[model samples]
Target: MLITSGNSMIQSLADTAFAYGRREGDHDTSIPDLTLHIRNTPTEPLHCIYTLSLSLILQGSKQVAIDDRLRICSAGQSMLTTFDLPVISHVTEATRYHPFIGLVLKLDYGLIAQTCTELNLERPSKDLRYQAISTQDIDTGLCDAMSRLLGLHLTPEYIESLAQLYKKEIVIRLLHGSHGMHLRHLASVGSPSRQIVQIVAWMKQNFAQAIGINELADKAHMSASAFRQHFKALTGSSPLQYLKHLRLQEARDQMLLNGLDASQASGVVGYESPSQFSREYSRLFGLPPQKDIQRLRQA
Candidate 1:
């Protein structure tokens, strides 16, 4: 009998990930396409970029808040984020004995487009983006596919030969699941959703540069009013709001990773005034930039 709801597969996958991860943070797996995330204790909310990816919880749970919208996902559940979103997220439930473990696969747009063409799938309409960030119970088939993907770690030699195939299988499974429509919309070209994605990519690459709504609207091939509406629909934030978050997040990273002072970081991320940067940083991070970096470093 095929096991659809059994915990054995999920548990084994967790064990494998834990054995490899061993430490208490995110780890890129031996398989280039997968990332292993482990947490031993509950955490404070953190701001980070969530890429277009599928995250499967193998043990414990997580709480993800995007644009103040919250979703809690636990073992046996999968969370799909279809865009690179600025999110506040943390592990809400974990322990040394049963650490929170997740296997995250970054979605490959090219592979998805190829699969859709091979399957003769049509693009989903723009309405699908409203449900882009979703959580649902992992179906048996998906769990089984994930188990197989994880097994490749045991035989490193097979990674080059089989990882891509398994990843493709996983994508195919996702395309048939509840969040399939969202993924389909993302892969289709010339749609409003695709235009939003293009605009988002441009913003990501050029967050430090000044941008105007009119320019963004033109890039999206929509009128200013329509662009504002569709941008919010796709990202849950207006274009400027999204750009603000992107700049602030990058500023934080600069402080944390590059050891830049708040003033320096602010200027680097295109904030014209240090005082304004501090205020916005405190508003988003719940602490001033200096203190937040100090706390982060100590932790």
Candidate 2:
């Protein structure tokens, strides 16, 4: 999405979500996509999910950390995560007074790919070095379309045919814009972005095993440094950082989805020192892993 469309979509969504509680520190509202509410706090250290359709920030500010790399996005800004990634997310500042709100748009690779072809966009190269970009760079045209879609969501009496057209139009702009390359990366396989995607596939398929950077690099047919550079460029994170995201999110999955305990789940996900894991978990997610799980359970 261009800067304009991106900003407008965020505003429109914020208006919709804001209509609900008036003030909510931490909340979730599921539309056709996901709306996340984050309150004023020190920030969170929870492991992140890389893939899934994501657009971030309706209000306030937060930072996303994967490995040692971090990116900050705030109100009027947005992020699109094309691949499934693991990282730590935090809401450094917000309040029921002004919460950190984010959106998650569901992804459909086939939809994006088919749209790209119709638009005459070029295919992305194998091995994407740079892909993820801030939505603040979006233009007004895209924003206007997205605002219309958001408006559609607000209008219950309307038919939904126009929403699909708006969606396709947004993808076309993304295709032609600087970040169009990122979407193309997903559609055309064997590109650098796609190569990292292949590695991501392996990690997901085998999250329990020890990872070798060289092997992952070889999977993409790039050397270690080259792979690291390109990987960071595309996803804004290093290989180890990417791996950790897989591990931590999986641990959360085991706890929330599979109903596992903290220590056991940590070990299962490849953490050797449980204490270290706890510390890192606390830092990344704010609360200790166990406490967070408990809170979720209580809720």
Candidate 3:
């Protein structure tokens, strides 16, 4: 049974999100770092990158997967992604009459660190083994704060001054919630998780460049084997596997958004052999580059 506050918060968020996200795509808001998503029908599994953010399901449900791990988030639940991760996700439940509505807020690591300091949050002695993605019931306080943030769309005048405070409240509530430990580790200095996050950020900026596990491990200041263990534990994939997923996702974006052809997209994302790129792309996305792009366009 949902608490009364939780139920009210869901209704509030759903109503506000529908007002802004009436169309069937992501809607960027005037509020900094916030986006709303609406879907009228169940969608095919989509391969994309989820940055450090919190996604709250206001209505319906969805399934998200990273490597072999899968999580299902229903209404009143929220998913926290502590790192920028390449994930496969699809709407699991939705209909035209009752569309899936969701709110996504980008998380700022700097703000998180500052909030931790202000709150005097202590670092955990050992970095707990946690995946980059986690799902939990939305805290009532956090849900209410999100509702207010979305409601700001109706009153744009105060957005410039008030949005940051609301965003900070959301982060503060997040730090006090179930996913707090994972987040705390991300903010803690010299933690393996934090180091891995740094490495992931570097990989994202230089994904098209040739990358080696040893080089990445060195950057993380860990031996290759330890780095591999921590990386897999946190991201659900090894360093090389994560890089491959990043490259493939980027190539897909290039083809879909920039009108790049399959071979061109392949080479642009650092694939030396178009055939090899096509093989891996097909394996990951279930279609060759051209067909995938065609399908996406037709959608």
Candidate 4:
């Protein structure tokens, strides 16, 4: 008997994910392809870099603010992003009885390309409204495929073999969803969005180094002004601004996770002056580096 899509089934999947990885921080399970997220209470807005991924909200709701635009997504809705985005997200609704449960599957561009070839799917037209991050309703077919993917946890024997099949099906179902056009544009070779995606990937890796508009434009094969326009359109931030956020976030992680001091972290993240780093860190995080770290530790 196949697992069918229903409220009860979705709830059960959420429960399983929660049980498997119920920590204050993010949880990764034996399933290499997915990450299960559970938040027991409402949280302050968190700023992070969102990769090209699909996030399914199984049990609660959250609000995501990208640039100046805000979107609220609830249970049964999916948040799809085609490229890296800097976002501020908060879990607006959650409680012990009904905790916020979600699953994030990082989309594999290579696998998407393979599926596009196999299905003979043409690249869709670009929509200026598609800002890389968009929300869509979760269709019954997609929910069913995700249920089966989560169900693999119950049967260890088939997990290794059957997980791949369910993952492919989920991607195919996404191709048929409301954000299909944007997804197609992302997977399409030579599309402007795809070109920016490559540039973003490079920027992420070399964020600590100085990068210029002309260099990035050349990488995307676009004129300087056109590259800036397309980059902001797709990522909602100027290229240099995007790099700043990435560096700041990484510095925060260094301080919080790696136990680095402010000056050390600032130097490591490419700041020429520690004072400049402190000011910017305070601007973004609402406190000085040491104070923020202390607050987080106390919390």
Candidate 5:
């Protein structure tokens, strides 16, 4: 029962990513939280920061670089990112007819916490943060819950009344899954993830300028060394490594949206050394910035 639904959800999401390829000029695909769409295409390598969102691939495959770690997710697999970290991701293969596809459920932790309290579910102390969620199979409890909630997506009249119920069910399903274990980590009162959340907020608000670790640490209300250790424990990267990813990802925006050259894009993203920027950019994205941008434009 639950196993079957997991299979169905994966197949559905994968089919969606594949549909995106037929649109032409489709970059790496994405399906919003309420809806799922996927398509595949043979595309030049591309990269984007997987903002702390829940992503599940239904078909084809993708490779993701998370700081020092590398992860590959294919059909029937999913990942949840708790912190807003930098990531380099690319679809390995796809085609116009049967593109890669996926489903996304963006978890709102605040909503989950509130629901937990309302439902009389006790949260753990806020001093713990889990690193990763790797689940091999989706259980029956999770599958049925998702199906009912998705059906609700079609009912606007009952949406407001049912939102909290659906959202809470979604969290409960995730909590029961391997990836769902992070609810414990996230609830810890002063946990590294708590600080990481603060840092994530600050970074989003202040990504345009160079930032100091001391400043970030202060935002987390910790000493510099302690902040470094905890940040690495949760995000698997040094402060600078994380910052570099942010800058490079920002440059990707310029290339894809405004059509900027690499040099100009580098300047916009705060790169003083053009050659060094190019190397790191290529290292993360699998191509020189100009070529990738040009390819993106041509496609």
Candidate 6:
């Protein structure tokens, strides 16, 4: 039956992924765009930004919350994010015997655009908007392509020659899959969604600096009101709210990874008031900066 074969394919993919992501952390493969994640235990909600990428869950499960929408992706499924959006995610199922294994492939917007033109796909109306994230069952074709993509690591010499081909195949599969319309909408030149994506990329780089919504709207060539509406529709957050999430997440990273204390991290991330930073940090992360960093370290 179709379901039986699908499960088998997923298991094979899991095996391939585990071979590379054997250690309990994120592994960057020789392929520049491909990364693998391995986790042996459930985790606290970790906040971060997801760029244009496809994350395939080969084993176990994860819960990803974007704004108010929460999606659960288990084995045999994948999550596609069309733009840069701040998200909170955590492993929901994993164990020493059955660790969670996942593969993340950074998608190329240029390639998506090229594929759309080659296929003559109709662009969605500029007035319409789509959510930045979606989850769907991975079809057999996509699974096979991904498995081969991972297998390319074994023959590194072939990777340089064939990786782009496989990556293009994966993009084509996505274009025909559930996320096709959304991807098309975002990749279309001069679309509002595409403009918002560019703005989000800018936000990521300049998050540590003070930003104004009107300034960003001008950069996107939209009136303040129109920009705000499109931005919210696509990312599920207002411009200021999204910036807050970015700053908080960056501050947490500084404290956890760089040994910055709460005040120092807050200042580094552009929070003028340490008290205000602690308040917002606790609101978003469920603990003060010091406590949250300590918990993450213990985990």
Task: Give the candidate number with the greatest TM-score.
Answer: 3
| Candidate 2 off by > 4 Å | 1-13, 20-31, 34-42, 52-56, 123-129, 154-163, 185-189, 209-229, 232-241, 256-258, 267-299
- List the global CA lDDT of all models: 0.86, 0.67, 0.88, 0.84, 0.66, 0.89
Tens digits of per-residue lDDT, candidate 4, 1-299, equal: 22222467666667777777777557776667688888889998978888988998887899999899898988878889888898999999989777888999888988887888788887785544655888876777877787788778788799899988888998898887787778888888787888998898898888889778999999999999999998998888899889899999999999999999999999888999999999998988889999998987886
| Tens digits of lDDT, candidate 1, 1-299 | 22322478777777777888789998987888689998899998888888888999888889988775889998888999888888889999999987888889888878988998899886776444456588988877888788788778889999999989998998998898877888888888776777888889999999989889999999888999999998887777889999999999999999999999999999998989999999999998899999999999998
Give the candidate order by descending TM-score. 3, 1, 4, 6, 5, 2
Global Cα RMSD, each model: 1.9, 4.6, 1.7, 2.6, 4.0, 2.0
Task: Give the worst 10-residue stretch by lDDT in candidate 3.
Answer: 1-10
Which pairs clash in model 1?
A: none
TM-score for each model: 0.94, 0.71, 0.96, 0.93, 0.78, 0.93
Candidate 5, 1-299: lDDT as tens digits: 33532476645533334443435333432222544545546444455555555665655667777666788776566667766766666777556555666556667768756655565554554553466433345555655555555555456567678766876776876665666557656655676777777787677666667889998888889999999988887777887777787888888888789978788888988888889889998987778888877776786
Write one digit per residue (lDDT tens) for candidate 6, span 26-111.
99998879999999999878888898999999888999998888999988788899988888899999998999899999999889
TM-score of candidate 2 versus the correct structure, residues matched by position: 0.71
Ten residues in a row with the worst lDDT in model 2?
Answer: 26-35
Off by over 4 Å in 4: 1-6, 22-25
Sort by lDDT, best first.
6, 3, 1, 4, 2, 5
Pairs with steric clashes in candidate 3:
none
Deviation in angstroms for 132 in model 4?
0.7
Clashing residue pairs for model 4: none
Clash tally, candidates in order: 0, 30, 0, 0, 34, 0
